[model samples]
Target: MGTIKRDKGLDNTLKVMKQGYLYITNQRKRLGSENIFETRALGGKKIIVISGKDAAELFYDNDKIERSGTLPKRVVNTLFGKGAIHTTTGKKHIDRKALFMSLMTEGNLKHLRELTRNHWYMNTQKMEQMDQINIYRESIVQLTKIGTKWAGVQAPEEKIEEIATDMDVMIDSFKGLGGKFKGYKASVDARKRVEDWLEDQIIQTRKGKIFPPEGTALYEFAHWEDYKGNPMDSRLCAIDLMNTFRPLIAINRFVSFGLLAMHEHPITREKIKSDDDYAYMFSQEVRRFYPFVPFLPAKAKTDIQFEGHPIEKDTMIALDIYGTMHREDVFENPDDFYPERFKDWDGSPFDLIPQGGGDYYTNHRCAGEWMTIIIMEETMKYFAERVTYDVPEQDLTVDLNSIPGYVKSGFIIENLREVV
Candidate 1:
């Protein structure tokens, strides 16, 4: 059995995700703790491989399968705070989700689209200066800024960028299980800076009274009271904005993963560029190939059996997203990068899912699914037409169990005009 080692380098992690199961099954002969193998920890809980689509469907029914294991407690405290959204139960979660959905109306969508386009044009030029930049980091900053602005928080780019970086660092601190303590410490400092920044913005907005006379997303939300009818706390509102950024960050990470797949599999890239509808199909393939959250956990609400394994009530169910997507039994040539698999089809077969969903706007299923697709389609088109760069001689191997290496170099956009 391989000992689970902490801090395996990027290269090694990629290797583990891609083939760790093969090593465990055929070579190792038994599932090891070091390997991400499905095993029963507590008595009679069925832990098995699952894909994004199934996970989405299952998590959508979250009430039936209550999330058993805890997400990083530090993350909950730092990013979401003890709000109606983050830690709430029963009616509270439902109501908070509704509040979040209210902000996603067509009016806000238009504003966000305009902001995203402007940011892309403004940032593309900046990218030309560096040999290579982390697209994931870049997208996160832009998206975070956009969300903050929607929340009526306005500040200098430098200041906002600094805050964004701190937020990201706080998020990264919680990468592996049991690292919640590390995140807890970082979140203290990070949370304070963010809260102070948000508090000032709320004060300024209220004082200026420049909000739309009738109502804006921010205005309506700022005025939103809980079930008891008390005014929502301004401090919690800012932290909610921070939580909004988390999913966006995760979305962009998967988007970058899609970009990497396109670069490496130019055939799929060409298919996507040929037609607009292909954009959605291409996204499905990308979702199947590269989702950020690999293992999503849900607790059993009652005793159940999946594939003959008895799962007791209240046990954590580890759904293996990567394994489900890559399973050959469900997908023909599952390893191949093919977009046609999702074209106008039911999309149930391939189990493609970029965003997790058991219910709309719940679990890891992003509320910004449409928003993410729009960005991905537009950005992929830009890169496909405008850029051409050789990947340097290096190991670009990927692992299903580990995070992928973000592209560091080997891309050049020769035709900026093609971005449109």
Candidate 2:
């Protein structure tokens, strides 16, 4: 009998080192490796990393590689559905991404940022009334309501509150609540609410009761195609938008965390605040330090041999963002939260990927990364300077199995009594 080895849930890649890539173990006990030269994990699912700028290049490389198969698709269908971003790959993914990018131009983004600033100011003003507030949770609710709504999507306020409540319930359950059964129930309930809301929105938009602006990414995505080449039905587009929206919500949740990091590390915060381009640098560093996603899961595309390892097709491969970010060989003082490190680095792009690199748009790369950076930079600076928060004794919690966390939304930010 073949004995099964359970997944140990370690930073799999971090534990093993080979010539080009580090090895990882899947649930099936398959081993794969990823490194500077090439990536072959889950038996033989293959990709290349090469260096830092290569990371970005790989992200933009759409023609040769794409996101497909069971793991990613299943997760998307379960969590995000067949939306414009996660549901499709290749040319279609590029087209959809292009639409999103085009809509994310400086002018549109500038407008979005202005509205966001107003929203943040308003929210923060309300928070100041209480000496102590849960900035993390409050930020999540505010960002979901204000952030996406400002981005031109009409997210229902009540629904946003419900989802926030559900998420918290699950988190509480994870932290060991006995009665709620919160994790399982919240996941199931949230999916239903998301589906119902998406259906209503699609029907409403189709009937012309609402119309997104002509160049709006969501508007374009309403007619996007899937890998099978059919235009995404309005229903699917609605579902997809929700999926895209979730990450934005999550990223913003951490934007508050980034602000906390900066406020605590005054020297780093002040340095970033002092320069124009440095704001972006700071945001990148924040992304690196407290990334929204740690494991980017992918499946093997075909059967192939790589680096003398025989990996079968269809195995699950999880790319390690946390490990890569902290790898000493790649970044000097790997654990330090230094935004300026990127400013001086001349390495390839593959080395520093908070976002997945190489053909990732069609794979697992984030569509809203540009907007995420913009929002983080804007939000981080605003809070670091204008708002001050008193964090609890815990600085950051290491999720060990998931994304790294520090100073979760458990603290209160004081000062600045009203939004302008």
Candidate 3:
């Protein structure tokens, strides 16, 4: 096997923290490797970064790559709680993932879509009464209520915003390492608060103090069993329960970006009002053009050769999710924010994976992906068709170097007027 150029650094953990989303893509460009490049990150471990269509295929291969011990401990305690679906693999993964897949049933997803639409409509009504509003924070409040209700988690309207605030703080901590000590501490505290609350709920349900309806996330997770038919620790079960509904609130970032897109492209904004199919394309474009997840790291399950070079077993590898979607070969004039590109696009899971590539039912792909698109499409539809507002002058720049990049101004809108 031939040797690929390796990054000249003893350890690249600091660089990865500094560069964030662009670290892998920048290295690939500098090394001039179209598909694969080598580097060391997260404390001098051998790591290879891969992009493009073929690389995506290999990255998601269950037999060739694994998820055990892939993510950093800080990310786990802060963003995704321990024992969440993002960590487990093999039969253990499949079994745990089934809990989420079950929640994604057509009936449940339809309910979620209806919930999204109703909440957006109400927010517009409220906005009409107010002088101005920040779409980012407002949508979080709206989605948190919707998500909690749909999951059968009994939380009051007043407490919903507080919970959303905690969840948002946890998600924002994963963006970059700047001021991470304070951010990390906040996130860890948030997780503990939420998890402790969820644990109490679990106990109440078991003791018959609270009896949530069957098939709801609260009820299912309270009774979910592992591969050995044993109940999960109450604390860990709370983590799994939190995973069921927290992702719905994450759609606030996409909603903020989608509104920004409409303001930037008036012609595209007007088109979605009349074309239902175009609205779907617009949502897809927002996911592609804007950044969400940057890269997903996995460990090589076996010794493998790619691009005439050897990748030893246990080597840390990452799939360049954001870079792959914007590759010139993958999408013509990829940098442009055109929704029409998806009109005739073939449905390949690997090409446009802001969420993750491969079969949603099987791989590490987000089970809530379909729900994300639905909620985004509904929110965009509401903004395009239901109301008219003005985008006030503000800093709308998107910082790509952040893990969960978003508009700097949170896409503020003022002078809300309803349209018949």
Candidate 4:
């Protein structure tokens, strides 16, 4: 057994906020640790940071670590609502996951992809009329509409932007309480507004005031029975309904990232348009190369040994998401933006964990992961093949120091028009 490197500090909480996505990786580099290190933060709360394939395997090992009550209240209240599946454990997790997986049918996914393409085609008309468009802003509106429509939740045209902004804020809230930049106040209010909106829909569903089509997300979750054969709490049902499609909205950032990629790597952009398979690879690379989540936390279920270090029961363990995907041992020249690498990529869940690393059915992996891929692929191909636009001079830099970063100016584009 080996002694794990401990951070020399009373607390490094503020450093994490300032460092953002690179915090853990920065720690490992400074500590000269292989894959695991300990950091004291949140007023000396012991946090074990683990990365790479082995750490992911252990993190998702339900017997070793569990997720219930692991996320901070601020995270739950904003990013994932109370009683979300991200906080489930044991048998309940299985049942709750089944509820989500049921909605991921192949036919349903196809419908979503079609919706993505349709929305993009429509948005181009609006973009063409305008002198310029912020890809990120327009993407939020289009994705929110697609997600709500696919989930059978109808948002009035005027309400789409509001709903989208709220959802986007919820995702951005993952940074937790970090001064004014984290937007803590906005995070709480965003969840409240969205929850109330969806709860009302759940109510209307029950009273038959609204008809969410069968096989759609809102309909299934609204009528869902808990593992104990009881109707789930209305708020939980609404949370799950949002869970179903809100992630589709989450892909809005990826739309911007994918466009940014096209602009930066012009050769790959031309390659992606002609090659469908390469486009999928490009989408996967976008998810891998860009930052989405920084880390995910779980608590040790019992005393366990990992990487020659002891972890006491109930210790908080953070799976280093950004660090894992960018590990050189996993990807050659890890810093480079290369899509071709995925062509020969081994299909290990732990290796490419931008969303998460585990069995989709039985673990806490993003249920809408497939939707992210589908939407990203469609968005990548659309802008690559269907639309012609100019990448105006703007801050295209994606700050590694930002949690869930986007191109600084949202990847500005001007003179948008249909492809010849």
Please name the candidate that would achieve the greatest lDDT relative to the true structure: 4
Candidate lDDT scores, in order, read 0.56, 0.54, 0.85, 0.87
The pairs that clash in candidate 3 are none
What 10-residue stretch in candidate 4 is worst by lDDT? 173-182
Predicted structure with the largest TM-score when compared to the true one = 4
Please, what is the TM-score per model?
A: 0.76, 0.74, 0.96, 0.97
Stretches > 4 Å off in candidate 3: 176-180
The total of clashing pairs for model 2 equals 30
Which regions of candidate 1 deviate over 4 angstroms? 1-59, 78-86, 179-184, 203-217, 347-350, 361-364, 386-395, 399-420
lDDT of 3 by residue, 248-360 (tens): 78889999999998998998878998887988999999999998888888888999777777888998998999999989999899989999999998989889999898987
How does model 1 score by TM-score?
Answer: 0.76
Per-residue lDDT value at 293 in model 4: 85
Task: Write candidate 4's Cα lDDT for 75-189 as tens digits.
Answer: 7878888888988888888998998899889999999999999999988888899988998888889999999999999799999989999998888887664434448789788
lDDT of 2 by residue, 1-420 (tens): 222233343222333322112232222224222333334433333433222333334323443233454343324434555453655655665666655555666776776667556677777757777766666777677667755564456766667787666434322322211122335555546666665765665566667787877555456566555456776666766666665556666664466657666666778667765777777778877777764444454444555333334334554444555556766666788778888887876644466677665433344556666777777777776775556555555445533433234354444554544323
Q: Which of the predicted structures, 1 or 2, would earn the higher lDDT when compared with the native? A: 1
Mark the 10 consecutive residues where model 2 has the least summed lDDT. 17-26
The candidates, ranked best first by TM-score, are 4, 3, 1, 2
lDDT assessment of candidate 2:
0.54
